[model samples]
Target chain A: MSTSRELTRCKTFIPGFDLISNGGLPAGRTTLVSGGPGSAKTILAAQFLAEGIRNASQPGCFVTFEEQPADIRRNLASFGWNIEKWEDENKWIFVDGSLHPKDEPVMVGDYDLGGLMARVNHAVRTINAQRVSLDSIGAMLVQFGMPVVIRRELYRVAWQLREMDVTSIITAEHTGQAEAPVEEYVADNVIILRNTLEEEKRRRTLEILKFRGASHLKGEFPFTISEDSGIILLPLSSIELRQKSSDKRITSGISELDAMCGGGFYRDSVVLVSGATGTGKTLTATQFLAALGEDERGLLFAFEESRDQLYRNALGWGVDFPSLEAAGRLRIVSEYPEVAAPEDHLLRIKKQIEDFQPTRTAVDSLSALERISTVRTFREFVLALTSYLKDKQIAGVFTSTTPSLLGGSTVTEAHISSVTDSIILLRYVEAFGEMRRGITVLKMRGSQHDRNIREYSIDSGGMHIGEPFRGISGILSGQFTHSTSSELQTLHRMFENDDEES
Target chain B: MCKDFLGNHVMLEIIDVLQRPDEAENEKILATPTLIRQSPGPARRLVGDLGEPDRLIQLLGLQDHIRPRQ
Candidate 1:
């Protein structure tokens, strides 16, 4: 086990996939890339070859069995990998194994791929390549008719590649089987890529099936392919639940509310401010940003509102967001939640956090994120995001809008509250014949908090935490009942009588 | 309803009030199981069920509503 831990890993340039694999495609071994049509199989194989040639200065041989070399070059140019340049510089070799009309006429009844192997071997020796890719081994398998013949030929190729001692990737189509019959027992490692519709939007996910003599993160990680970033994998399984705990606390901008929270929220803690619509959720989040020190920076991800709209709203609450932005103490990123996958959202937030390195972060409302994906995906996104922030030791404040005006609902109730270190519930309490907003510290993990449901109001001064609702009951239930004056007087008289008798 | 009035009257009434849309909005009858008495010196409104008879009587001065059990 320890030896495997210390085993040398060939890091792939394909971002998060390598991280999840514990290391990239075990060194000097074969990895099978299985996926359906248009599932990024060819792109991954090309990236592996390109990554090797460019980063490691390790020349590679891309043996294409489907697309012609020229066509491959055309496709790879979009990824900014100049295949022609590498080929001309003698740093890379392209072995076109694609079946042509000439090969069709030359074929006989009894045949062997000895000629193909010779061509690949000559190319590998020419460049002294360190990596090799056999894209769409399925195409070659189809060329060989019988299953027994295909398996025998594949084993021979696998053996030859093993003898060559260069890391290799063989791409194949997933034929609805655990181990696709052809390359079943051949490859040292197997990775399956899936492209399926999730709520009418395309969602791509990849999973590692088997890693010989190595342990890897075990789960299907979501990925996306873009023009710029070829294949971006969001590996949730690789994320360790090891966040450093801090004794320090950060203020929520509202001093009284901070006081109620027993000296504010803990630094590196995830605090959720959940309430109904139009109940000052965003305003409270702005106050959190305002509370940052002069040198400290805050990053706000506004999903429900635009950056300009947030600025206007914060200005109304006297947050001075414009001044903060001008002073370089704040960054507000506004984007629609439905525009991308939940995994993309995680990666985008991570990218922002890395670039901005903010002391504080606030997602204006996580409720909108719930609308973009399934509940399971949303939960994973939230957990992954919060744990990541905690790892960075940044104070994160997320706002969620509850559906009900009284006491229930919001994303917090969707088990998001359990992951958060603190939960503050804001609700509308009817008092004095009008709707009045109230705030309460529902749960504060690892800290003492005032449990009283204090009436609060949003005004020009922002959210002000006033005294606890005195002589009233059922505030949380949305029922307002003030102590009856006559009853109070009777109680006072009774108390006086008892005092006089004593 | 009688069991709740005998049991945790205040809690039951609060829950009941929260469930109802109209009654919870009413400023006069804010809480549920609101027991109101008229023509008893002066009208009085009690927020919850009259769990404790003596306290309820003194609160609303409802002497007529109180019936002594044999």
Candidate 2:
């Protein structure tokens, strides 16, 4: 029995088809690559041979029964492999198995793949081919009418190739049957490639259905075939790369804001600052940039404010934009929601992240993003942006403007709340005939935080957070009444009665 | 309905529901905007626009911790 610790060491390699047969086709075993028309069986087989030649410095052989050698060469040209050049260097071999008109026909009992097997053996021995790909076994099977004869010939060919000590990939055409071909049952591996339509979108997927003698991943893997890169497999769905924990924290620049966040926000955490207009959402975000000190780098993406106005307004908040820019720690980019797509914005931010490598990033207000696309698109954008920031392990702060300050209504900012690791709510609270600002920590995932609603104020010196309310009523409703007055009178009467009794 | 001051002594779960009432309330039974203070004592229910944290604090007789309004 395997313990948890021992089981953790097991790793599987996807051999471009059902799991690569334990240590990849037994180092000298025969495997089959079978698929229907346009199933990319040839491409898969060729890629296996090509990858070995390029990556492993191991020579390989490609025997084609369907397409001409020139056509295969042209098709794989985009992947930067020169098969013809490799053939000249005596490192790779390509064999054309198309029958000629002058070839003589023989009886079923006398017919054999003796010539084909000899050529394959010679190619492996002469070029030192470590890998070999037979484009399609279907053509060979078609030539033999009797199932028993065909099966016997295929078995003989597989054993001969194994004796040559080459990792062989035999290709077959799938006929949409519930059961695989007879050759597949005898082979060491079986892989299936297919296209599926989901929600009117066509997706190309690959699954390793079986790999004999090997424990393989059984789920379908999503991949894309580009004109330049051919097939590029994305990260598998099963693996999760966790973010490294750090002790560093980011300041909101505003002293009051920083205090509300338990001294400061954690490094690499996403913070959502949501408030109504004129409540200083952008100012709070700018304060965050200003508090980074002279050495720390900060990036600010303003979708609503222009470059000049942003600088001027930030200056009003006592932030030294000129000096920060001169020190090479602060970068500001102005974006327009109407003119650019979300992808364009993502690319621009990605470039900035690469160039500046800032420790902190702020999206000045998500309201602008709402104007550019549908809710679904906006959500996707937020997810992608958060994923990108998490990849860089940079602390990000996003400001969102709620439509109103009171009553139960969807705070336009609701869409992005889930993606943010923390939410800081700023709003106006009325008390004693005056409107005061209040701040509260709505949620802070994976960290402990103060939950009390504290009164906050902003003046020439910047923001300030005060103690919690003492003896008032209706704090969230922007109204506060003194309950102490009536209670004090009652206490005085009780004291007088106690004195009389004494 | 009851009110209190010094929300520090308030039930944490009640505070959570009060902060985001829209999400906590169930509309299936015509249960419009109900606030259930489920901690620090017996649970109490308050209906209507209980948006004013100060008033709720006062009605709950928790003014000792609350400071006098400026």
Candidate 3:
């Protein structure tokens, strides 16, 4: 009879990579890092090995098939990594695995990887290396033409590394066409790096395609390669850590809009208010914030308007900004389009979220966020921000301006529609020879809401949602085409006549 | 109607009963998660997940008396 015993798995909390990976790379296994030229494949591999040596105090070996030891040492020295010092301390080993000049060519029948295996074994045995990185398996693949021989050699290398309890990272250059060969199947993990040109700008991305013996997050994580940090992987998923809070309602000060949002905004729901320019989008958002009173904290990130101008316009709407500011419940951050990047805006909002911990947040127009990058990047930015808000359980209101009031449902503000939990569309409708406002709830996930277009108006007292149009067609198109049915017209006249007689 | 150990009054009032006796014989009779206001005036029921205390109070017409905990 065999007794079941629990095995404890060791985890490394690598500084930059750990957070994105949920922890460090899986230990005691093989991880394949594949990418094209200038895709940071070598840098990423070195990051894993260097991080292990520095942070975890685990010795690692770097086996290079392309670069010489002197060049590799010199290149890494610029990144502030003292490879010689670590080598002298016996904590690191850099082995040159390139093809030698005097090495004799072998026949197809008796191909041998015994020499390469012996070198790897020696490095592991001498340094007690816990991590081993083969820099360019592509070069090795070119040298060994036969698939069967290459596969056998790789399998043997992986088996020996496993037996010696070494976590190996094997890197290969992707041909920018098909997937890498045999590595995904033979190795325990596979990570693919891609550099795509979006809107004439280059965007670098990293994706963990496969990881055996463990459950991994499946998504393309955007990353950057810099001189300061070799490779920084930004997890596509938002930070999920948030403090739980009691549920409470914050009013929009507009009674009609409140009814549309199921009695104002819920504790942590994200409300996206989209409309055209000069349609009072910012005013509506400010009115919502102003209704929170002098006690509850509310923050606004305005990308279009200046802070002074926003305050003045908000003051025109009868909002008490001075009192709200004095009470420390209201804060507005104005940013210009030229000075800020999407990451800068995200980081600033993240810092504010950490500092104020506001119950409510309003981004006065996602239009600027859309202009900062391509549609995909903008989508990611919105997703990351929404994820942050959802994790915090904070009720957020995002305002965006559309190019046309009667345009198609396709929003010009990137792909923000899908990321938003609820979409409140406000547009100017032409009726009775006057332009009137109409509000409609496009979609609200996880909750039931009214789906009818309600006529709304804004004045001194704020916005008011009135009855829906009864005798109109094409309400969403702003201009309604009313049918002139003689019978209905006579019935209306009859009712008016009866009222006059009474 | 009965009282729990917390000294709060609880009830399983089925206003529209049209079924068999066995169907209603369960010890814990289930109803919609609704808050029935019977204190100030005419009774009213507010339904759905009442996660927001302030919205619940306003919906129940008890915003004047129900003070939120800071």
Candidate 4:
């Protein structure tokens, strides 16, 4: 209770959890984690102890008032926690408080829970444990059916755990549909786990409701469970925006496009190329990744096409994908967005980026993945990927397909415009009864870029940027406005200001 | 303590908690003074000081089991 010293924190070593918790749980304090059934509450509690044993060699004690210790051990073995071996090595202990049906005790007069406390204390001392988990105080209510006694005893247990100097998590069950829980005042630090269904998709999130006297990232962070790992949270807000700006330039592989982007794209920048299906958005991403340096590698995630189709398309564009991959420089992974959730897709994409350690990555057609995620989730996915690449000083190209074939702004571009360093728009321009293509650098950060809409055509060699499209207006909003004879002269005067005449 | 009430009908089994800690833990015995009516339909357990003989029988619902010593 001393306010003079800074509170210590205990890192759980759960992936992405420590970052969002601003280090970890408050040290030597009792944190009550409340969630509904099947919300992975038990898994999280066990992981707190398991990670302690695995990461730091710190022993732990589990005081369960519901499920049997054997059941917990068996259920959590998929997480690679060998509870039986830990018990044999004196690194883990379980104070089984499970109310065996045959051994159910009757409460005629009065009781104190001294026996349970004694067992818990004995187990803690047995291993010199630094962490402890009390699985669900709600079950104890069923056993005793006395709310007053349980509340008093729970407060006492919290104090006792503090005295023992162990970081602990006491899990409790709450109805998921309700917006409030009665146990908000039960503990100083509280975390809530929610598994909610939105738009027929299950989204699991972990929210730190309050951390008394400590700093933590507020709001819910999306999380996913994998077979190898129990629960992995995507701490989007934890990603710092203070990425080092790199002045170094890399080519977009298209010579005219590079000249238009003020020499070239920044080395650590994320360029979002947005266009319709036939406007060659994928071609722009492909060219960007193909411009990797001699020794540098490239990673491409193709969500719209298969491996052979991508290779064939690249070969048609005069870029040999098979030989580049043979040289150990290029790696391509293609998958449908419906195969996994947005969190899982991001995790897998990140895994590839880490494993390959590429200098550049191109996700061909980010719009393909957008269909599987909600607007908010898609924004987070793009932000996470963009920041991840920028932090590593890796250039990225994310292609997004607009909903319409003509000049139109895509939803993906609108959501991720601020996150990307540069935005390139490719549109279908219907000029003089002929459907033509045009490209323009819409926005660029910290660099002067070509602002005029220039006509471009996709050939066997790739996108070739030609002369600027004059006398055209409203090409961005999926409309064409022809200029009058007098207005065309004024447009010519504006082009004369560009100093392009030889 | 309740020997007078169930003189002939009761089969008294005394259990020392310190010596038989396993049995105490098995029964989830947290308190010292405890009484259990094992047989005669559904079993029942009454813990703590029984206070009086009538209250003990009333609490345990063993009014029929209570009889005078032969």
Among these predicted structures, which one has the highest TM-score?
4
**Native A-B interface contacts kept, per candidate:** 0.00, 0.00, 0.00, 0.28
Tens-digit lDDT track for model 3 on A164-250?
888888887777776556666666678888887667666778877776655556777777654554665556464554535435666
lDDT of 1 by residue, A241-287 (tens): 78889998888899998899999889889999888898888988899
Error of 3 at A372 (Å): 5.4
lDDT of each: 0.77, 0.66, 0.68, 0.85
Give the top-scoring candidate (lDDT).
4
Interface root-mean-square deviation of model 2 in angstroms is 41.3
Q: What is the lDDT of residue A387 in candidate 2?
A: 66
TM-score of 3: 0.63
State the lDDT of candidate 2 residue by residue for A1-502, as single tens digits.
4333221111112233322222344457676767777767787787777777776778888888667688889989887778888889887887666433233122212344544565566567778987888888776555434566556767787899878777787888887578877776777667777655444444456666666655556666555454453554332333334667566776767666566667778888888887767777788788888778556799999999998898888777677787888888889888787665554566567778999999889998777877775565466567767767876888898888767674122344476676678888777776676777777788887777777878877765556779876555555544455668778688779999999999
Which ranges in model 1 have alpha carbons more than 4 Å from their true place? A1-8, A101-106, A141-148, A175-182, A185-188, A471-502, B1-70
lDDT of 4 by residue, A324-356 (tens): 899989999999989999999989988898899
All candidates' chain B TM-scores are 0.43, 0.43, 0.47, 0.77
Largest DockQ belongs to which candidate? 4
Better of 3 and 4 by TM-score: 4
Error of 1 at A400 (Å): 0.9
Candidates' interface RMSDs, in order?
Answer: 44.1, 41.3, 38.3, 3.4
Docking class of 2: incorrect
TM-scores of all predicted structures:
0.78, 0.55, 0.63, 0.89
